[model samples]
Every structure is written in C-alpha cells, then in structure tokens.
Target: MSTSSGFSFPGRWRATFHQRDLAVFQRVADRHWPGAEPVLPRLSRSANHGLLWFGAAAGMAALGSSARSRRAALRGIASLAVASAAINTVGKGAVRRERPIVDLVPVMRQLKRQPFTTSFPSGHAASAAAFATGVALESKGWGAVVAPVAAAVAASRVYTGVHYPSDVVAGAALGIGAAFALRGVVPTRGQLPPPGRPPADAPALTAGEDLVVVVNRESGSATAAAAVIRDALPLASTVECAPADLPGCLEKAARQGKALGVCGGDGTVNMAAAVAATHGVPLAVFPGGTLNHFAYDLGIETVHDTVTALTSGDAVRVDLGRFRPGPQGPEGADGYFLNAFSLGVYPELVRTRERWAPRIGGWPAGVLAAFEALRGSRPLTAEVQGRERPLWLLFVGNGLFRRVGPAPGRRHNLADGLLDVRAVHGGRTPGLRLLAAAIAGPLTRSPVHAAVRRRKVRLSGLTPGTPYAYDGEVASSGTELTIDKLPEALTVYCPMPA
Candidate 1:
C-alpha cells in the first residue's frame, strides 16, 4: 500500500488498518441478510437531519411527564448537538478520506441524500453515542430506552453505505468525548455537591424556656405532627391555627418566645421564617407538611429529630429569600421564603395540583397539573435585567439549588448568600417548547431556558395583577417584583451530624 502523506511508521500502520477496515466493510455489506433490507433503509431515512432523535427526546419529555425524564431528554438533545459539531467540523475536516463507491455498496441499500462530507467520521454514529451517553447520565431508565435506538441509528449508517465501519467507530468515540466535554462545561443535576454542614454560629436549642410552637391545621400532616410535637415537648407552648390566622399567630408567638417552632408545610414554615427573622429569634422546624421539602433540606425529618435537637442544643443559621414589591406596588409590602419563589405557569400548576393532590396523590397530581399548564398557559412578558422578553416561568431559590438528575430542587448550602435563578424563555409555541423541554430535560443549549446563581434579580412589565407563588403559597404581585438574598438571616434547629 502507498501513503498519500509523508511516509512514517504510524502512517504506514494506519494505511494498513484502513485496508483491513474496507475489506471487513465489503464482507459485511456484501453478505447482509435479506430481512435487514426493509428495516435498515427506512431507519436510515427516518434519521435524516436527526429528526428521529429530536422526536425521541420530545416524546420522552411529554410521556415521562416528570422533571427527571424531561431533563434527561434535554441533555440527550444537547449532547447530539455537541457531537454533530465536533464530528462534522473537526473530525471530518482533519481527514479527507473518500466515501465508499456506489459499486462497493448494493444498489438497493444506498441512501438518497448521501452525505457529501469526508467519510472518516460518521455524524450519525457520533450523535447516537453522545445522545445515549448524555441521557444515561441523567436517567438510567430513559437511557436504557434510548440506547437500542441510538445503536440502530449508528448501525444504519453503515448498512445504508454512507459510512465505512471504521469511520462509524471513530465517530462513536468522538461523540462520547463530546458528551463528556459538554458535561464538564455545563454542570448537570448530579454534578452539584451535597448540602454542607450546619454553620458554626448556629444557636443551640435549650430546655423549656419561652419556646412557642405554632402548627397549621390545614396542612396535610399538621394534625398528626402537632400531636407528636406536643408529646415530644410537653413543656413548650403549642398553638394550633387555621391557614388564614397563621401569620398573626406566628407574630404573637415570635414576640412571646425566645425560640419559635413551626410544624407545617413549606408555606407555614415560610410565614414562621419571616416572623423569626423579624424578631431575631431562633426557630425549630418539625416535619409536618405533606412534602416537608424545607425540613428535609434542613436535615430535620421527624418530630423525634426536632425533639432530640432541641434537647441536645443542635441548630444552624441559614439564608432567607426576600421578595420586595417593585416600583408600581404598595409601600412596605414584602415577603420572605425559606424555599423558593415562582412566577408564570408554575403558580397555576401548583393550584391545580393542590385540588387533585388529596385524591390522586402528589406525584400524579403534579403530572396532571404539568400537562394542564402546558395546554392552557400563555407566556408572560417581563423585563429582566433591563430587557423585555416573553417568559414561561421564573424561579428564584433562597440558595443555590443542586441539580439532582433533571431537577434543581436540592441545595448544598442554605446560607450560600446567593439566589438560584431559573427562567424559561418564551418562543412562538411556548407550550410546545415547554412540553419538548420536559421530555428532553433543561434545553440549556437551546434558548428555551436558563439557570444562574445570583445575589438578586428584578422583574418588571407585568400586568398590574400578576400571580406568583412562594413556598407553595400563591399570591398576587404588582407590575414589578424584586428577589434578593438575605444571607444568614435566621437560625434553625437541625439534628447534629453523626
């Protein structure tokens, strides 16, 4: 065999390998089973311009109907984009190998729009590997479903006589590498560190002096939780209040107690956090809500845990999210959230979920609400950072939320002095985009959504009566809204590390 480039030992070996690779391709293509003829041609056509993979991602997001599935689908799509770029631009450009001639391939199996680029690397193979790897990193189940299809797409490239076997192998490696490279650049849900230990200055709970516990009876688990708290801390004063009376009750308790304990869901805890912050008093949290997201993040899971922490004097100082009314709003109107503040379709989804949660259960209700929100909601137009844009949703968390799989719900540090801000950019078909995003996962590569860590965020250009949600409680906001982080704003009791 003769070398096109200057003769070298490695070049000689590569040329020999290419000869063997072509020989193997000839054998495989010439002896193809008749059964594969019908399937391979259609598969090759279906994958044209990557419409098949895009459709798969979108379908997964819509059918999976959960945050995790949506994220996985999005990650897969992003990986495909990266892989395609690398293979088409860098891999193919680096080598000028010609594609196999039509004589070498059976006439019946040839593609109509044969790729014109150098055949040293196959874009289809690269995209297939990258998408499969990316989805697997986000969700194993979704990855499993995608793997066979990806493999089929890669194999179809060779079966259709568009790429040599060696070219497909090289493309697969490039694609996998692209996926990993992209993963490093953009942190995924699994990349975030776990929640940090409690702050050193956190106050310790003491035995039996001016401890007031307020419980919201309206919470799903409040009645049972209140009973447990009463049994656990007999000396502490306990007050049961309706949802409407919670704020006033919390204020009165904050003034009377050296420490305040709240037993309810995120919304109830949010109210108590505001009162606790104002009074400069330590707070104790008992897991009494349906989801108990705040308490779980705080590492306090049960009444037993709260009692133990109170008796042992274990606690931590954490941040609070403060929301102030914007320029066109009422004076002195502000609020605080221990978890997050949400705008756009999320508030409506929450309300819809609440109505069905008791009957269908939380997960099912959430899925149903997601579909409803996607079907019925319109994008909101808001001014963010001085630019007016259409938005589907805006979420601001008290601290940086760690991405776990497809969801950015968990936090690594409660006192990070930063806000976890996320927003979905509105498009011509906002609902369709949202559905596609949910099926594919975060769509960060596309202009569909964005996530960032910041100290503050401002939004304006809202219709006078715009609705928003904070810690699961819905409320109306003015034309503008400002969310700021309050670092180390409140102290709360949590179980000591083992």
Candidate 2:
C-alpha cells in the first residue's frame, strides 16, 4: 500500500507501519526538542481523507462490469497519471522554493526517500490534485466531490513538514490547470446536466416602490426578527416560506408590485436575494443565524439599528454559487449554495451541533459539537477554484475576510468579490488554533493558520453519505459537493457607522 525507502509493504502492514512511522516521528520530535514541544503536524491528521478517496475510487472501478466501463476507468487512471506529471513533476519543479521544514531544519533529511526535487510547490499535493482532477473529468459526480480530498491531502503534506503551505497552494493550482486542460482527453460517462437558466417568466419589481420579504420558517431565526422586519419597512411584504415557494412568492408580489426584504439565515436570504435580483428589487437582511457570517460580512452586525438605512442600502451586483452535479444518474437536479457547502468535518459538525443544540444550549453547544467532531475527525479531498488537494477543513465565503468588512481598523467590507477559504493540514494543535481563531478579537488575523480565498470550492469523498448544509440548512446527502459565491447579490441593511 505504501513504500518505505522504496520497499513496498504488504497492504496489511500499511496501517501498522504508518503507526510506527508516526511513533518515530514523535520520538524524533522529542529528540529534536527536549523541553519545548513541536507544533502538531496538520498534514498527518488529515491523511485519512486521501486514503478514503483512494478506496472509494478503487471500489467504484471494481464495480465496472462492462468493457466500456472498464476502459473508461483505465482512461481515467491514465488521465490522472498525466495530470500528476504535469502538476507535480512539471509545475512544482518549476516553482523551486524550499520546503518550510527544510528551511527550518536544512540538515534534516526527508523522512522518506524522495527525489532531489524542488519544494516550492508540493509534489505530493500536486500529484493528489492532478489525480483528483483526472477523476473529476472521468466521473464528474464523485470526481468533482473528491477534489476536496485532493486538497486536504495536499495541505497535509505542508503541515507534515514535507512542504510549505504556499507549495501546497501552487501544487493545487497546477493540478486544477492540468485537470481542466485534460478534460477534452478524458471521458465523463456519468456527467450530470447543468442547472438551467432561470425561467423566462420570472417576477419583476420596482426597487423604491414596494418591498417583498421571503423567509424560511426552517431557518429557526428568533421571533424578534419578524417584528424587526415589520418595523423596518412598512411597505415591505413578508413571505415566510421555503426555498421551493420563494419564486412563487416573488411572482405574486411582483404582480402586486413590491421590492424585497429578506430576514433569516443565509439560505433563506439567498432565495430571497435571488428572487429580488430577478425582480429588480433592492434587498435588506436582518441578522438571524448563530454565526451571522453574511451579516458580519456586510458590516451590518446589529439588525435593529440598521433597519432604516436598509431601505436605501447600496445596490451592488455580486456573483452566485452554481453547480451542475456531475453525470451520475439523471438530469435537472443541480443545486447551488449560498454562504458555504462543505464536506468532511464541516458538515459533520453542522449535523452534530444541530443534534446537540437542544441539550447543550448556546456557546456550550458549540463546545460539545467541536469535541464530538474531533473524536471522529478525518481528512477530506477538496478543490478550490481549480486547485486540487486534500484538506482537513475548508470554509468558502462570499468574499475574502479583508473584502467582506470595512478594512479600516477592525471592520470588514462585504461587497468585494472573492471567496475566503481556510483549511488545516491534519494535526492536533490546529484544533486549538481554530478555536483561538474563532474567539479572537475583531482586529486580529492569523496567517500561521491554514486558509485560502478564491472564487469556488468543489469537494468529494469524505463520506459515502456526505451531509452538506448551506447557510445552516442541510442542502444534500451525497458525496459530491460544490460551493460558489453569490457576490453582492444581497444589499443588506448595512449603513456606515455613526
């Protein structure tokens, strides 16, 4: 399953040897530093996701009964090989930066017998990304989903002393480029159709004349939000409903001729914003979620104070998250996510946190939820924008941290067009790092942490039943996942501070 200085081990010994090597690594850690402790390697912690993806693909390959399917699988493998060579061999070598570990300890030899390769872009990361890309091209559904795993794996290499975080990033970029370039050469036998264009006969609205509010009862926002809505805009009509009913509500309101106001979680807001955009209406949001990431991004932290300004909130154009689920079975079930659509630890945390919310209320729930997640954590394959690599954790945002809030002092501006991504190579300490990052003051930024900001995120193969939630709602329960940003789509109640 793995090689130790060029000697292949039996599959059964892989696990045992891995443990032994890890033990050796720890001992090495101790020998190198007697009193002080070396920070935990994030890469090692996230490796399981890579192994999981490999197994899943191999299993899928095994299920091929027809010669055509077998041939397709073989071609996919070949594509992966080509991609690996391109990203890892060509791209990484071209970016010849030294690994952070080598920079830190130049005397230390690579743990394993690797080539005398340059370390600017991580080769392992590049290879994993290329492989994920190749897989995505062949089997869009699972392949697209597994891109996250590739990212996770790539990230782990950096965290584990094999490369620099930047190296992983470059490798991912290379992998994605290779995957896209190779798409013409690969066969996607089970590709899914795209989410079609919005129906031609959608709603219409006059921005200043009237307002329509679309709310999801499932968002579980505070009862106070409704009152805030009623007082905020007397002309704004409320349509407390689900996503499916959003378009209808918009259409009905358009007939009545109203603009829009959306007060709920990101999903609810996303639906409302979409309808508002379709109908040419200015939109307003009331902060309602536990995190209220969107609200924070928009610099509208308090709902009550900003209501009046929301009526005249700046109208800005933004992008949207789009997906055409790969060819797996049927057509026309493509979906999109507002805020984030994550796999691996993120979805698991959402599910676990929701289940425990009733028993452990408030911040306590978050604490318990994180504990549960850590107890059963694993690596994930992921692709962002187009970079292929495995990662332990990934968060994609509508805009970069700097862009989402007022950059002056502590505030961030939300209108800029970029996605903020964060991931940690597998490690024990990164958990603490994450906690610290979460609790840190507004002005603080953590560069030592793992993160990337891009336009899109695609992930797959963390679990057979990957439960992803968007804006805190369970969007789907399958392996494939895609997350894109809807930029400046919602003009929330964001007023310049007094």
Per-model CA lDDT versus the true structure: 0.79, 0.52
What is the C-alpha lDDT profile of model 2 across 375-432, one tens digit per residue? 7776665454456655556655544443211221111334455566665544555476
Off by over 4 Å in 2: 1-209, 215-222, 241-256, 302-306, 310-314, 322-338, 382-390, 402-411, 427-449, 458-464, 477-483, 486-493, 496-498
- Predict model 1's lDDT versus the native: 0.79
lDDT of 1 by residue, 1-77 (tens): 33232212275687887778777777878895768888887887887777888998989876762346776888889
Those runs of model 1 whose alpha carbons end farther than 4 Å from true positions after fitting are 1-194, 197-209, 326-329, 357-364, 428-432, 435-445
Best by lDDT: 1
Worst 10 residues of 1 by lDDT: 1-10
Worst 10 residues of 2 by lDDT: 402-411
RMSD of each: 11.0, 22.2
